[model samples]
Target: MKPFKSYVVRTNEENQVTHQVEEVTESFLGEGNTTIAVEYSSINYKDMLGLQTKGGVIRNYPMIPGIDLAGTIISSEDPSLSPGDPVLITGYKLGTEHTGGFSEVARVPSEWVVKLPENLSAKEAMMYGTAGFTAALSIAALEKNGMKVEDQPEILVTGATGGVGSVATQILRKLGYENITATIRKDYQEESAKEFGATKIWNITENESNGRPLNRREYKYVVDTVGGDLTADVLSKVDEYGSVAISGNAGGVKLNTTVLP
Candidate 1:
């Protein structure tokens, strides 16, 4: 096999983190039953953290940092996968504890691979990478919990301009949802939120709270990508039998709320 270029992140003895693209061989890849010729990879929040020193994302030094990839198989020891097969990978130890998809070539366990849908190209698959996957999962969970588009329920998607929130908003709109409310931190993001199919744009104030255990029942469903006090506040606003799918903690981890809501 020929050498390929990869984005590598390394930490020094002084704990300084640095990253660069360098040529590497197949031997640099982690142990796996399959090798893929990576066509595309997408950046997620976790990928950013993986590039930072002690960011708590990467489990080892001298690592590649991409959580999602779409590509065609080059070779595989597993019979279930074969050369020329299109596939995508997300989650698992890829890009963290294992050599990830930032490389032109990637080796991952066969169990981590999913055949890409016929309608989706490798580039399109990566565009919906891990962030979009998370958003889709959140929406699926809400639907399973009784969310219905026919009811025209008010759905709130926090962090509306972010990858997950933006995808979720667009997905809901495509699913015929008409009452989507998207929250953004800045006024300027309203247009972007609207472009993502949000029927209403909410300007979220950091650490804003009404000091009550529960506020008015505003939304029937929530796809919260930002955690912390924002989640606490949203929790109080969810209607009875409604659902809130929490997928991130970009805001903070602490949630101070009563059990009433």
Candidate 2:
């Protein structure tokens, strides 16, 4: 009913970072037209990077780092929305630049909040989170790029065990994409991928050679999560004018390429 606790990440006197669970007061939150009683938040890969000492995601010291949250508005200054409305929010620098939702409450700009769809709940929204949204964006991008389920011979989803990959696989299946191939490094993720509608699964190694640019027209569509060399490899093996919907840089950020004949 009042102010509450929030987990925060900050830098120490030596400029080394630290993370602690601390009580947050009412005044510290950013200016907002709506106040939300935070209900659920999810651990995204970006959040993991921000939380881990090894992850350099948090650029500013003394920051909160949650990328997604779902809750109900307590009050609203905006006429487009009212009090007691449920909302879902991901992206828009929620946890990066402003106070975020790894807390009992969050006061956020009303524009940052998205009303939950009729069939979806606060809990369901968090379950999908930013990763799922990114997946949707990837598929939507593929569609925009002229890759259609009815036309593509096969669609390859790389990083098949990860959050984006999982969601993409499910959505693709729901969209009736039957010729789906999943590429993963772990043998254990096959069953899970199959559950999501991956008919073919393969374990690819970083060491495996992905011979030559523009290999024998394998995939008409690719949803790539791991970038760097893998992205390079996938690009090379694409069918003429095929599309690769790229979304993450988990493996490596740099992408190098040379055009094929």
Clashes of each: 0, 1
What C-alpha lDDT values do all the predictions have? 0.93, 0.83
Off by over 4 Å in 2: none
Give the worst 10-residue stretch by lDDT in candidate 1. 202-211
Q: In lDDT terms, which candidate is top?
A: 1
After best superposition, candidate 1 residue 41: deviation in angstroms?
0.3
Error of 1 at 217 (Å): 0.9
> Which stretches of candidate 1 lie above 4 Å from their native place?
none
lDDT of each residue in 128-206, candidate 1, tens digit only: 9999999999999999999998899999999989999999999999999999999988888999999999999778764
| lDDT score, candidate 1 | 0.93
For candidate 2, report its TM-score: 0.92
Candidate 2 all-Cα RMSD: 2.0
